[model samples]
Target chain A: MEPLLSILIGVLVAGAVYLMLARSLMRFLFGLILLSNAANLAIFVSGRMTAGAPPLVPDGMDVPPEVVANALPQALVLTAIVIGFGLFAFALILAVRAFRSLGTLNTDDMRVAEPKEKG
Target chain B: MSWYLSLPLILPFATAIICYLLRDRPSGAWVSVAGSALGLVAAIVLMALVLQNGVVAGQMGEWPAPFGITLVADLLSAVMVLITAITALAVAIYALSDVDARHGQLGYHALFQILIAGVTGAFLTGDLFNLYVWFEVMLIASFGLLVLHGGKEQIDGGVKYVALNLISTILFLTGIGLLYGQTGTLNFADLAVKVDAVENKALLTVIAMLFMVAFSVKAAAFPLFFWLPAAYHTPSFAVSAVFAGLLTKVGVYALMRTFTLVFDHDVGYTHTILLWVACFTMVTGVLGAAAQSDFRKILSFHIISQIGYMILGLAIYTPLAIVGAVFYLVHHIIVKANLFLIAGISQRLTGGSDVFKIGGLYKSSPFLAVLFLIPAFSLAGFPPLSGFWAKYIIVKASLDESLWIVAFIALAVGLMTIYSMTKIWAEAFWKDHPDGIDPKLSALPGRTALLVPVIGLALLTMVIGLMPEPFVTFAERSAAQLLDPTEYITTVLGPEAMQAADPLEVAP
Candidate 1:
C-alpha cells in the first residue's frame, strides 16, 4: 500500500508541476490544488496503513489494547487539508481578481507590479 | 511559566479581535498601537525571564514534553520576539498615519495585529507542525495585507507571491510529513534526541534538503526570491516594512533553529551548500538592487542581499559565525524597516517613489535626509553604525575559516550596497527635482506620526553602532546557546529525558 500510494503521489506531483509550469495563472492555481492534495496524501500514507482499526482506547483504559492506526498523521493531514483549502480558495479568488484588474490570466502578461523598463 | 510564554502571542491576537470590532471607527488604528505597546511590555518580560533562566519551556494543557505543544524561548528566541515587538510598535504607529480610513475600515489594523501574532508564535513555538500552522497564519494575513488596496499592481504581485509561497508551504508540509514518518515525533527537542537513533542517515539528509529548499524560498535565497521584489514594493509602506523586517527573517530563524537543533548530523554537507547559496544570494541581490531605480524596489532587493549575509553567518557555523548571524538578524530588522518607513516619508514629500523623478530633498528636508543617511549608511556598512558591526563580524568569521573568496564576496557585496545607497542618496536627496519642486518634510501631512518611529529606530541603530560591547556579548551568549543545546533540550524535555537518551552520563 505504501509503495502504491507513493507512486500515486508521484503521478499527482508530476501533473501538478506540469500545470504549474504553464503560463496561465489559472493553470498554476489548479496545479497548486493538485500539489497540495498530493502532500496531504503523502502525509496520510507515510503514517502507515492499519485497515479498520480505530485509534481509540476503551473506557477506563489508559492505552489501547491493540495496535491501532497512527492518529497523529491523520490529525496533521486533516489540518493541512483545511489550511490548503483555505489558501487555494484565496488563490482562486486572487486569480479572478487578477483577471478582472489586469485583463489577462497569463503570468507573463501580469507585469503591472513590475513593469518592463521602457527603452 | 506558560503565561510568560503566551503573553506576547496573546496580546496581538486579542488586539486583532478588538481592532476588527472597531475597524469602522478611527480608534481602530489606535487600538493597534496600544496592543503593540502591550506586546512590547510582554516581550520585555519574556526577555528578562529568559535572561534569568537559561532556557524556558512550557507545555500546553499540562502535557509533558515529547507529547504536547511546547512554547520554548532560549536567548535567541527571546531577542527575536523582543525585536519583533519593537518593529510591531513602530510599524503600528506608522500605520496610524499611513493607513487611510477606507483601508482602516477594510480591517487593515486587525490583519496587521494578526500578522504580528503569527510572527510571535513562530518565534516561540517548540514544535515543528505548530510552526507550520503559524506560518500559514502569517501567510494568510500577509495575503490580505498585500492585496488590501486591490489595485492592478497589488493583484498582480499578490498572485505571484501567493503562488510561490504556497509552493513553499506545500514543500514544507511534505517535508514535515516525511520527517514525522521517519522519527514519529514532531517536537524539536524530541527530534534532537531521537534523530541520532535513526539508522538511515541518508534518508534524513534527503529530508533535510527538502526542508532546505522550503526554507530557502521563505528566506528569499538565491534562485527562489523572485516573488519578493515583485510583490514587496506593491504593498503599503507599513505592510512592506514589516514584511521586509520580519517575514524572511522567520525563514532564516527557522533555518537557524532546525539546522542548529535537529539537523547538525551532516553539517559538512549542509553548511557547504549554504555557503555557496549565501554568496550567490548576496551578489545577485545587490546586483538586482543596482539595476532598480524605484525607491522601494531597491530596498526590496537589498533585503534579499542582506539575507545572504545572515545565511553566511549560519553557513560558517562557528561560535563566532552564529554570533554574526544573530547580530545581523537584529540589526537588519531595525535598519531595513527604518529604511522602508523613510521611503514612505520620501514618497509623501516628493509625490513619487522613482528616484529619478523626485529630488531636492536634501535642500528642503535636511532632517529627513539625515534620518535617511543613518540607516542608508548603516546598511552600506559605515563604521560606527549597526551594519558595520554586523558585516565586520560576518566577514571576520568567513576569514577565520580562511574562506577568502567568501569574505571577499561579503566585502564586495557591502561595497555594491554602498553603490546602491549612494545612488539613492545622489538621486533622491542630492539631485534637483526633475519637476522643480522642493520635497519638504514639514509640508507633508501627518509628518509627526510618520517621523516618530523613524527617529526612534534610527536612535536604536546609533546606540547599537556606538555601543557594540553589550550587544556583541548578548549575541555571543545567544550563539553559545545555539551551538550547544544541552541546556535547551533539558529545559524542554527535562533532565530525565536527556539522561535516558544517553545512559552513559555520570550522575552529577
Candidate 2:
C-alpha cells in the first residue's frame, strides 16, 4: 500500500510539473492543486502502513496498545489537506480575478506589472 | 517567561481580530497602530529575557519537549523577533498615512497584522511542522495583502506570487514529511540529536537539498526570484515596504537555522553548493537592479542581492561568517524597509516612482534627500554606515578562509550596488523634475507620520554604523550559539534528555 501510494504521489507530481510549465495561469493553478494533493499524499504514505486497530488508547491506558496505527501522520495529513484546500480556493478566485482584470490568463501576456521593455 | 515567548505571537493576532472587526471604522487603522506598539514592547521584553538568560525554551500547553510544540528563543530568534516588531511598528505608522480609506476598509490592517504574527511565529517556533504552519499563515495573509487594492497590475503580480510561493510551501511540506519519516521527530532539538543516528548519510543530504531548494525560492535567490520583483513593485508602498524588509529575511533565517541545527552533517557538499548559489545570486540581483528604472522594482532586485550576502555568510559557515549573516539580517531589514518608505514618500512628493521621470528633490526638499542618502549609501556599503561593516565582516571572513574569488565577488557586488544606488540618487534626487512642479516634503499630506519612521530608521543606521563594536559582539555571541547548540538542546529537551543522547556521539 505504501509503495502504491508513493507511486501515485510521483505521478501526481509529474503531472503537476507539466501543467505548471504551461503558459496559461489556469493550468498553473491546476498544477498547484495537484501538487498540494501530492504533498498531502506523500505525508500520508511516509507514515508506514499499519493493518492494526485504531490509534486511540483503550480505557485506563496511558497510550495506545501495541500494533496500533500511527496517528501523528494522519493528523499532519489532515491539517495539510485543510490548509491546501483554503489556499487552492484562494488561488482559484485569484485566477478568476486575474482573468477578469488582466483580460488574459496567459502568463506571458500578463506582463502589466512588469512590462517587457521600460518606456 | 512562557508569556514572553507567546506574547509576540498573540498580540498581533489579537490586533488582527480587533482591526478586522472595526474595518469599517477609522479606528481599524489605529487598532493596528496600537497593536504594533504593544508588539514592540512585547518583543523588547523577550529580547531582555534572552539577554539575561542565554536560551529560553517553553513547551506549549504544558507538554514536555519532543512531544509538545516548543517555543524557544536563542539570541538569533530574539533579535529577528525584535526586528520584526520594529518593522511592523514602522510600516503600521506609515500605513496610517499611505493606506487609503478604501484599502483600510478592505481589511488591509488585519492582513498586515496577521502577516506580522506569522513572521513572529516562524522566528519563535522550535518544531519544524509549526514553522510550516507559520509559513502558510504568512503566505495567505501576504497573498491577500498583495492584491488588496484591486488593480490589473496587483492581480497580475499576485497570481505569480501566490503560485510560486504555494509550490515552495508544498515542497517544504514534503521535506518535513520525509524528514519525520526518517527520524520520527519534528522538533528541531530532537532532530538535531537523532539525525546522526540515521544511517544512509546520502538520504539525509537529499532531504537537506529539498529544504534548500524550497527555502531558496522563498528567499528569492537567483533563477527563482522573478516572482518577487514582478509582484513586490505592484503592491502599495506600505505593503511592499514591509514585504521587502521582513519576508525574504524569514527565508534566510530558516536556511540558517536548519543548516546549522539539523543539517550540519554534510557541510562540504551542501555549503559548497550554497557558496556558488550565493555568488551568482549577488551578481544577478544587482545586475537586475541596474536594469530597472522604477523605484520599488530596483529596490526589489536589490533585496535579492542583499539576501545573497546573508547567504554568503551562511555558505562561508564560520563563526565570523555567521556573525556577518546575523548582523546583515538585522541591518538589512531596517535599511531595506526604510528605503521602501522613502520611495513611498518619493512617489507622494513627485507623484510617481519612475526614477527616470521624477527629480529635483535636492533643490526643493534637501531634508528628504538627506534622509534617503543615509540608507542608500548604507546599502551601497559606504563608510560610516551599516552596510560597510556587514560587507567588511563577510568579505574579511571569506578572505581569511582563502576564498579569494568569493571575496572578490562580494566586493564587486558591493560596487555594483553602489552603481544602482547612485542611479536612484542621481535620477530621482539630483536631476530636475521632468515636469516643472517642485516636489517638496510639504506636498505630501500627513508628512510627519511618514517622515518619522524614516528618520527613526535612519538614526538606527547611523547608530549601528558609528557604534559597530557592541553590535558585532552581540552578533558574535549569536554566531557562537548557532555553531554550538548544546545549550539550546539542553534547554529545549532538558538535562536528562541531553544526558541520554550523548552530545559527543556525532561526526563533524
Clashing pairs in 1: none
True contacts kept of each: 0.69, 0.69
Model 1 Cα lDDT, one tens digit per residue, B1-508: 9999999998999999999999999999999999999999999999999999889999989998778889999999999999999999999999989999999999899999999999999999999999999999999999999999999889988998998899999999999988887777889998898888777899999999999999999999998999999999999999999999999999999999999999999999999999999999999999999999999999999999999999999999999999999999999999999999999989988889999999989999999999999999999999999999999999999999999999999999999999999999999999999999887777788888899999999999999999999999999999999999999899998887675654222111
Question: lDDT of all predictions, in order shown?
Answer: 0.94, 0.92
Over 4 Å off in model 1, which ranges?
A117-119, B502-508
Q: What is the C-alpha lDDT profile of model 2 across A46-116, one tens digit per residue?
A: 77778868878889999876777778889999989988888989998998898889888888898888877
Looking at model 1 chain B, report the run of 10 residues with the lowest lDDT sum: B499-508
| lDDT by residue (tens digit), candidate 2, B1-508 | 7899999999999999999999999989989999999999999999999999999999899998888989999999999999999999999999999998899889999999999999999999999999999999999999999999889989989988998899899999999988887887889999998888888789999999999999999999877888999899999999999999999999999999999999999999999999999999999999999999999989999999999999999999999999999999999999999999999999989988999999998889999999999999999899899999999999999999999999999999999999999999999989999997698787778998899999999999999999999999999999999999999999999876665653322111
Give the local distance difference test score of model 2: 0.92
Q: TM-scores, in order shown?
A: 0.98, 0.98
